[model samples]
Target: MGVAAAQVVDPGSFKVHHVMFTELRKLVDRIIQIFPKIEAARPRCSSGIKALCSLNSAIDKAKLLLQYCSESSKLYLAITTDAIVSRCHKSKSLLEQGLCQIQSMVPVMLAVEISQIVDDLRAAKFIPDEFDEEAGKVVRELLQRGASASDSMEYAEIKALQTAASRLHITSLTAILIEKRSIKRLLEKVSDSDQQKKKILRYLLYLLRKYANQIIEEQTDDTTDRNEGAFGSNDPNTNFMHAHAFNVESGLENKGYDSHSDKLSIATLPEEFRCPISSRLMYDPVIIASGQTFERIWIQKWLDDGNDTCPKTGMKLAHLSLTQNATMKDMISKWCKKYGITIQDPSMQPDVPHLLETSSISIASFGSYINDLRLPLDISNISLGSLDASYTSDGSRNKNGDGLNLAPEQNSDDLRRDHSSGNASKLDLESLSSLAELDWESQYKMVEDMKNHLESDDLACFSMSSENFIEPLIKFLSTAHDLHDIRALKAGFQLLSTFLNQYRSGIRCLNEDTYSLLSLFLDSEVTKEILDIMEVLSCHRSCRSKIAASGAIISLLNILHSNIIDSRERAIKILRNLSLSTDVCSDLVCLECIPKFVPFLQDTTLARHCIVVLRNLCCNEEARASIAQTPGCIGSVAILLEIGSHEDQEHALDILLSLCSQCVEYCQLVMDESDIFAALFDVSVNGSEKGKASALELLRLLRVTNHDDRQQECFESSNVAPEDANNHAKEKKSHKALFGVKFPIFSKKKK
Candidate 1:
């Protein structure tokens, strides 16, 4: 039996086996050579050497089995061969396990190596060129041998090789099976004669199918979880599937694919076709940091919710950015197209770029036309208050010849009646005619009614201003006399002030004509409200020059001289705003307004604004000298340094610095006031960095110019002898003159 068995395994078969083992050994050696590179690429992969050892052992065992089969004729050779085959199988299994660990861990570079090896083996059919002659001889000898024995030997050898190949092949295939089409193509190329390889291919195909199915199930579970609050069901598809089933049954009543039929042809989609989060078909799929794919909206929501971990793996995500899964999206798109289902891509649509370009061009063209177009025509013809035709002379009509009436002085009863009726007349041609015709009392009553309406509902103010009523209101206020038309003037100013407060456009409507009218009333008793209106108007740059031109600075300065504290404060603020313009500041100085701010400087509430106004006025050299010459101005500013806030101290110090910079007398004045000098020194020690620096700079300047005078005064004040004072002054000069001089070390010297 041993002889027959040995003969049955032909010498040619042994030659084929020897060549096969040698090639496999060579392949293993090539793989081993790459191990160092692989290990270097993935030092954290601890199983690299273990995997290599398993593969090497399997290769060695296969060679041993082949050698034993070729050389021995012992009766126990078959038993020994079976034992070797079992060992080789075990080693191959271990190699597969180790390779799987390495593949899972070191997927980037090592995976490329394994993929390349698999591709080469599969393309070459695992047969080296050196084994060609032996392989041919083995085929001829197998033909000469009886069919049964030849078939048995061929099956054994091919089975062993297939087992080894399948184990290693799976490690490579498993890494890339997520690409369903690629896996399918590779499976189709596997040989049918090699059962082990075929089995592996089928198993991998099963895994890919299972993975796809799991995606659908996972999506369904997520959808169910999301809808559970509203639907009270574990299955999200309960309603959808039932409705779909009903629709199919109703629509295809007698068709073979009816829902009622047990053999219903339902399409089974792959898991990759659905989103892991929503359990719906993905229209815009994206990949996250965990290498899992989900719908873009669902994943974005997850990130927005402040979850920094991946839902699938519980791994902390390194990044919240999502990459578009273009491949998966394309696959889903193709599948949807085949099924005649429309899918809306959440990304920018195909026409979006063209639409955006068109919009931008249209906007640019419109802007260009606007730039070329003339300014809009002045629409100030819209009348604001009711007009009574009784006061106007027929020839003295407004330019528009609108027969506008200005309301005449009616009794309080008439005014109350007109307001209660809610019949505020709109501005029109007749109203303009009556405005010119109306007497002062009638105009007064008309404005009084409008003021009442404005106070009750401020929206009335918007309507009145929008109608171009500000011009008429300003004209009436300007023309009304302070003594006789005081009520009419107050009413008109009140109405205009409301317009200024309620609408910025109203302030803008105060053109040169309106400002001309405003200038006439600067000396009116209603100066407080007039100043209030000017304050709002000053905010607009266009109105500032007009207000300055209108002699508003003189009026504001007069208000500052008023005994009313509120009036003074408001006057100071308006002056401060007006002082922003150098021209306006010059105007204030020309009006001798510098002396007016001096008294207010002692008022702490008004000190900051007063100082600020003075600061602006002092920008001109004439104004600076004027401010320094203003009695008590220098003393008040110096006092502010001692008791003011940090900002006030900075401003005061700046004022003193400016004054001293201009005239040596002011510097001497600051030095003569010991409080001022002490304040400067104190600020140098304890003020803010900028303030301290300025204070130090002032002290340094004072010391440079008046050092001897200051020191002599200090000596005289302290009762030091004139001789010592002279020596002290000379020593101080010498100390400064010396460069890098160190003082003598003072211990209790020679004690």
Candidate 2:
């Protein structure tokens, strides 16, 4: 009979209760037959439905049957379910049974289509309506029965629900507890079990966080509506002070009560997904907002382009991307959905309840982010929001509009280039001897020898086929002690310059760090000869060598600009010579050094050299825009046109033509000045071929000048505009304008 009954019911289509009832009916008859004396001794045999006791007693009876059933039988398991339910109904334990039933049903439904069936059962007429008025009440009351029993009960409940949830493969349930107030209270009651509490807390917190923004937004809207009618017109700010005077009245009068099932829904999820960390729901979701993930290279690029969160996680990072694990993404999604919130993906794809579009900052393409801060530096473990001052490679640390940290680290090479007063001056006789650990006499001797050879023209240049002589001179300088003696330092500088002149490979061999150091020495060395030596070194075989040398000169200029020098006039002369060198001129233009030297241009001795660099930069297509931004660049061009010898006027005109062709904004800067047009016409009519060429170039630039090109040019220039022209220009008409600046004097800002 048992075999036939099992075969007759299709396990796939049959309800668990229907199957249980059928098996129990057959099992009860068998029990009666097998122990007829036992049945007669107790009471008259009744129908299987009437044979069950209280829920606890029925469970005890099921355990008794389990002991006798020796072998696994569908009938035995089925009988246990029937007995438990019947006894639960009989003993007034229906509420607890419903709670247990829902707990089991929800997780299983995640994998199967049991939600409909579970809902029907939930609504079915029971012995009493309010018997299960509260979801966690039964478990809470059962706690007073015994401490261990309560603990065991909660543990088993969490385990059973979690096991079912895993089978259902519904990860979202883990965070629902926080949304249901009753379930939250139930969790609070079981706070002694830290692990269980954490599981509940993690899922609940997840739900709360997901819905937090939406709730706030809704509340804000409601507030605005309430104040609108009272204010006459709907200016929100007008009622702001009085708005808080009114409060939201709480009760069932105006809102639907959070249902018991809703509270249970929250309780049920954490028990479903075994927390990956503890094989239980997470106790505390790791708050990873402050570490290396916050300071990702790719993330920072986004922030610089106006981004405010992780591209993948939608957590606010602002121009900085934090590196995080892929698992976190899945977890966050589940949490968000449970709370009916939308979290945008890094790709800006919508994924959630409201289906709201992400902000522009969040949806920016990877290319755009990278383009914002184009210069590469080592910036690991530094978040845009919580960045450390020491972590940046660029000298200045500033926040972008998105509130992301955008600071570049100071490279060792940069330190060498900007020879500012305080630190360099301190590196004198005592410090040098200590830092290098060599006597001053030996260093002086090497300098003397190098000087004599250079003066007599006896130093042999290294052939292209052999090792570079410039490299050895650099190494010697690194260890040389004569660096302390001003005279010795000058001679060493002279020797280094001579090597630069003799060997083409030397410039390429020197790393950025060495270049910076050389620049620093030039800026700080207390002698004209050393300054002269730097001028010679700044010259190279071709424009490329000169370009590399320009980087070094800029670094030196940056350092020297900060400190007052006794021989500022001589130093200006050397800078002017270096800027005029065609080889390095274009590099200076691209690095934006010309603009930075604008203020110095008015320094009669320095203005001419600054003009030469700008002229060369304007001539080169790659650097024209940078030169155009120079504070006095436009005025300089005008002055060059209005007053100069024929050759000088031609040179100025040549630069003007280059600037107009390559940089529209620069043309606009020139056109904006009233005197500039007249000067261009004057140069065009009265000057040489070069002067006319320049005037024509200016006209072409003005014609091409427009909003579109200006936006594209500045936006595409770099993540960091390393140099600013107004910062280095003459101040007579200096000013700030949209899209950065018009022109400022170097007096307020320097290299």
Candidate 3:
């Protein structure tokens, strides 16, 4: 004031002072208005609002100092202004700190309040209108931002809301508000510097996966219980589901409930928790008409990809509509809450767009693509038998050069008669020629159609003439011997197998040329098909002779040694059928097929077939003697009597009876086993009528043989004459004297 008086207070100085005072007044008024808004936004918790009140008190004290300074003298004004400036700076500092503190706590406080509201909603507990409106507002605000557009702050808010909703078990609302794809997008958007956001996203995903897994488990348990009730506790199918569920539960337990702040990695997530389609945790699951449930986005994308069928079932979609799986969504939410993982808004998910170019690809183009990737053409070049080497040059001559030319005018009756006589039908020849000219793809399709025909229509397959097909089939096999043309060979074998299986007379159609071709295939790589063909061929007496003569039995025996069950079964079946013929049985015996057949009796599935073969072989004395001489043959059959089925035991006992009846030594061999008598007794009492009769008869025969042998031994030992006894004693004394002399001579030689 003294300085102002001395200077005579110029207009510029007065104007500067006025401007300063005006600006200060405006600042104070603005802060006054801001205080109430800050108070209103402050969290309702006592701790949350304490900082805001302190900030308000500081601002009020500064305002009081400013108001008091306007009425004071210049000197006093200067002192009061200093105090006001100090208070204003203090209040400004406090306000900034309070704002940050409040902002930090806002998410937590909102989470708590919203959780309460959600709990109320879930329990159907009374919620005030204001509380309901507030929760709805928060949910709407979080969902307003698209997942791709949302930043870290918005993501945090959405996560808080989702956590609350999930805790309340409001699955439908949670799914609607926070989608899985949106969380993935938010996670992707998080930069390296934003580790907090990344962590939050990861935690939210963990919760999603955990809860999804739990829901799946609960549903699985429910389903298993229901299935157990419906199908009974012994259902094998339900055991698989229970095992899978247990594995998933065990995985979750091993993972434990890690803290949300800890660095949980994606690799830790269980694969079963992931969607089968996307191979990620399911967000919004929907059930398709096929009864399979998948995440909505992926399923929708699959539908949009021009796939008109369910991926799992491959059944045509009756309708593409997805039914919301509310239960799964609830489970995902609860899993997150249990593990302290925060969930983000559903709206933040990214849009999974389909590739437009895929729709333009055609099946024909796809086939061409496969063809381009096929093995090199030169690899298919192999020296196959020439068509002209065996068949007529003009295709008009038969094997004996009997010019069996068929003109186009030949009637169906003539064709039938020729086919019945094992000659190629002209129609079949033309068909085979046409088939040979077709491409590989066409040929494969034809073969598949033929297989289907064989499976579905036995009469049609039998009625179809094999003559035309056989020649072409033989030609096809010879030409397709190259590894590159394996499909053609496979198809040819399949057609041949079907032809032989359906029509017994079809085996006769194999002339010398065809027989040689078929014999060559018996040693080829397609053993399964060839075995099946041979099995059918062995059904006919003439074919069995031809096959045995061609030395195909060796190939069949080789197949029996393979570890493959189907091939072994088929081989045994063929041998069993062929053994019905005495000549074949003798050949089998010479070839040592008995040892191979013996071990198969242990297998329940093959036991019946094996016993049949042995039974047929036993018809011939040489074959029976061969079987009885084989090691473990009698014991293996004895085991079958103990453990085999009713039919098996019957057959096994019959084989044993036949073998033992052949010679007393064989009966003694069977009787020597420790458990043979017990097994026979058990079978006699508990076995089927046929089995019981067989066991009883065998038991009686064994007892009679034993009685006779014992009687003969006793009769010979007790009925010795006195003169013979004296002679025997003299011979014993002479044997002892010779041993005594030899002992000294042998000892002297060793010394």
Candidate whose TM-score is highest: 1
Model 2 deviation from the true structure expressed as Cα RMSD, one decimal place: 36.8
Which digits, one per residue and each the tens of the lDDT, describe model 3 over residues 1-751?
0000011112121111223333333434544444444455566789866655454443333333333333222211221233334433443444334333443343333322322222221222111123223433443343333233236743554454544333222233223223333444334334476444343344434334324433333434454465567556544234433543454345333432344323235325545445556554566878898878877766775776567788778888888899988887787767665665654332132232222222212211221211111111121122112222422143343222223222321355544533332212222223454667788676666555555555443323323444556776776677787545777777888877776665444666787666556667766677777777777777767777777887878878887788888888888888888888888988988898888887787788988899889888888888778777888888888898888889888888878889777788877778766578778888989999998999888877776676566456456547788777557546444323332353232111343
Error of 1 at 577 (Å): 1.9
**Where does the lowest 10-residue lDDT sum fall in candidate 3?**
1-10
- TM values, all candidates: 0.39, 0.30, 0.38
lDDT value, candidate 3, whole model: 0.54
Computed on alpha carbons, the lDDT of every model, listed in order, comes to: 0.53, 0.39, 0.54
Candidate 3 Cα deviation (angstroms), residue 478: 1.8
lDDT of 1 at 674: 38
Better of 1 and 2 by lDDT: 1
On the 0 to 100 scale, the lDDT of residue 158 in model 2 is 47
lDDT (10s digit) by residue, model 2, range 1-751: 0001112122222112322222333332333232222222222334321232221222223222222222112111221333434432322222223222222212221212222222323333212111111222332232223223245644543433333222211123221221333223223323343343333333333223233333334435554465556765344433432332221122112222234334434545443233221232332223244332321222333344455644446666433323454565466457646765442221221121221121111111211211221112222221222122222234553432233332221344434433321232222112222322345565555444544443332112222111333444455565453445556555566766554554333455556545555655654543454455455545533333543554555544564465555345445545555555565565555555665666764555555655665665555666666556546566765675666666666666666666555555555666666556566667768877766776666655554463454445456455444454333332313222321242221112345
Could you arrange the candidates by TM-score from highest to lowest?
Answer: 1, 3, 2
